[model samples]
Structures are given as C-alpha cells and as structure tokens.
Target: MITLDNVSKKYQTRDKGWFTAVEPTSLHINQGEIFGLMGYSGAGKSTLLRLINLLERPDTGKVLIDNQDLTAMSEAQLRQARQNIGMVFQQFNLLSNRTVAENVAFPLEIAGWDAAKIAQRVQECLEIVDLTERAQHYPAQLSGGQKQRVGIARALAPNPKVILA
Candidate 1:
C-alpha cells in the first residue's frame, strides 16, 4: 500500500512568484488496486503522482509505501527503495541509444543480475508486453506506441512490488 500524509508541493515561477502545485492532501492506495488521478492541464495531477515516487518532494508531509516513510529515507536508501517501485513515464522515457531488449534489461543489470538471467528476464517482460519481435529494434526505429510498449517492458523487468505506471 501507498500512503501520502498531508503532502504538498510548491514552485517559484519566474514572474508569478511562488506557485502552489499541490496543496496539503492525504491519500491511501491499497495493493492490487488501480488508481488514477485526472485533471485538466496544470492541475497538479502529475505533481501528485510524482510525489508518490519522491520525484517531487512533498514540502509538508510523509510519503509511505507499505508503511515505510519514504520522505525520511537517505539518498542511498531511496535509491534502493526505488528498485521495487516501478514507473512508466507519460513521455515514455526509453534510452534512445539502446535496443528495446537493452532498455528492458537496464534496471536488471543495475541490480547486478548475470547476463543469462538478464536475457531470460528481458524476454519474459517483452513477451508480457508483446514486444518480443521488436526486442532488437532501437527507439528511433519503432513507432510511438511501440516505444511506449518498450517503456512498459522496462518498467516490468524489475518485477516490482508496486508499479507507478
């Protein structure tokens, strides 16, 4: 489960002074449930999601995952914690220079998996997203939808306990 306790975020705009992106808000998301945030442009929807991943730090409160306080974790601890919390960005952030299989294998490689295991896991994830045929293709070689599929494959390669896609 994920919990946000009175979380908020603000930014200093170039001409508008301080802008509040997210106000003090609390939320709880249970395991195995699909939750979504919907809003018009500039409505803090993205900010709210970013806060859960600690990509945007909440100025007012705690971010907890499975009851552990993410806001209080050290940088190293946060990095380790991130391994189990997968995310697929709205922009589909695939590495341009890497092949689809390489992109999917990247996180597993960082986690210190052996080559054979990495290959096997990459194949498994690709099959899940039905991107197995495009595994050898580069990001530029695939269409936008295909790129998004690659992003999904990469996000699943870690076998995360919580996915933020």
Candidate 2:
C-alpha cells in the first residue's frame, strides 16, 4: 500500500553544512500488515514518517501511496491526498484553546464539512476513544493518556485509510 524508492533526506546546518539524515532506503508496506521502523532517537525513523506524509520533502527518490507518486503531485493534490492519511504525534499535540469536541472537529473544518456533519463525526470519534463525557473539557484538564486519546480522535476524524502514529 506504501512504497519508498531509494528515499534519502538531507539537512543543511549552519555549522555542519549538509548532512544525510536518511540514506537511500527502500521499503514497502503492504495492506493489512503491521510495519515497524525501529532505531535510535536520531536514527531518521521520524524523518521517514515525515517523508511518507509529505510534511518533509525527500531529497531524492519518490514516495508512492497506493501507486500514486506523491513526490510528483502538486501542492493542492498533495493536500487532498493527505486527507486519506492520519497522523498522531508522540507528544500528543492537542489544542489547549479548544474543547475536546472542537479539537476533533478541527480537521473537518479544514475539509469544509458542515456544522452538523462535523458535530456528528466529532461525537462518534469522542465516543470511540471513550471521551464523550469529556467533550466539553479543554486539553489542559486531561491526563496524559486522555490527551493522547483526544489527539487520536482528532487524527481519525477524517476517516483516513492509513494511520501514522
């Protein structure tokens, strides 16, 4: 379902100049399978994930999701394609200003879903993560696990096909 062809990422630093974060790595992730990228903290695992989501462009090679070359897509096209992908961060990046329900509805807002539809989806997602009762609570009010659950709900709000967490 996902293919990385000779992907490499490089970063330019002020003092260090250009450094290769990820080498020419080729990987394939099939449908209905679990894949793991294990390495040390600075081992480029997170960089690879960023490449998959197009949050960070690869220096060389290509990223293909379901056979569509994302590296060749336009900015608008890439944005649309990213709707099918969901991501959760290890830091649980929840909006402190919004309630749980509103946080879950943020992506739907960007996708131009109507109020009624967003409300319905947000409710369903909160219920899925067992946070329906806390829908009105802000992120600061929740524990670490609860905050992560809200993040998961927000990420899943768009009904994505691939989840990157």
Candidate 3:
C-alpha cells in the first residue's frame, strides 16, 4: 500500500517567491491496484509522482509505502527501499552505452542478483515489453518508442511492488 498523509510541495522561484507545486493532500493506494493522476501541464502530476518515490521531498506530510515511511528512512535504508519501488521516467533515462538487455538488467544488478538470475529476469522483462529483438541494441540505436519500452522493461525487471511512470 501507498499512503500520502497531508502531503504538499513548494519550490522557490527565481524571483525569491514561492510556487506551490502540490497542495496539502492525502491519498491511499491499496496493494495490487493501478492508480493514475491526470491533469494539464504544470498541474503537479509529476510532482505528486516524484513525491511517492522521494525523488522530490515533500515540504509537508509523510510518504508511506507498504506501511513504511519513506521520508523517515536514512539514505542507505531509502536506497534499499527504493529497489521495490520502480519508476519509468518520461525522458526514458537509459544509458546510451548499455544495450537494452544490460539496461534492463541494471536494477537487478543493484539489488545484488547473481548473473544467471539477472540474465533470466532481463530476458523475461524484455519479452514483456516486446523488446526482445532490440535487447542487443544500445539506447542510441533505438527509436524513441523503443527507448521508452526499454525503460519500461528496466522498471519491470525488479518486479517492484509500486511502479510510478
């Protein structure tokens, strides 16, 4: 489960003013459920998603995933916790030098999975995203959509409990 308790975020503008990105809000997402946020540009959709994974720290409130408060975790603890929370970025942040398969295997590697296991999981995830044929290709070699698929495969490689895309 994911819970946001009166969460809010604000940023300081260049003019030394404040811009409220997210208003104080509370939300709950049960296990095995799919939830989406929708709005116009600059509507805090991205901010809200980033808050869930602590990519952007909340100015107020707590971010809890599977009953643990992410905001309270130490850096090392948070790094461990983040393994179970995958994120597919809008920009498809794949390593230009790494092949698709290697990119997908990246998370499993960070999680300390052995080579054989990582290989198997990477293949499975690539298949799921229908990027198996592009596995040996580098990010730069793939089209935009293919790059996005590689990002999806990478996110799924860890079999994360919560995925923010």
lDDT scores for all predictions? Answer: 0.91, 0.93, 0.93
Q: Considering only N, C-alpha and C atoms within 3 Å, which residue pairs clash in candidate 1? A: none
- Segments in model 1 whose C-alpha atoms lie over 4 Å from true places: none
RMSD of 1: 1.0
In candidate 1, what are the lDDT values of residues 6-96, reduced to their tens digit? 9999999999799999989998999898988888999998888899989988889999998889899998999999898988988998889
Each prediction's RMSD over C-alphas, in Å, is 1.0, 1.3, 0.7
TM-score of each model, in listed order: 0.96, 0.94, 0.98
Cα-lDDT of candidate 3: 0.93
| Number of clashing pairs per prediction, in order | 0, 0, 0
The residue-level lDDT of candidate 3 at 89 comes to 97
Preferred candidate (TM-score higher): 2 or 3: 3
lDDT of 3 at 164: 92
Task: Select the stronger candidate by lDDT from 2 and 3.
Answer: 3
In order of TM-score, best first, we have 3, 1, 2
Error of 3 at 2 (Å): 0.4
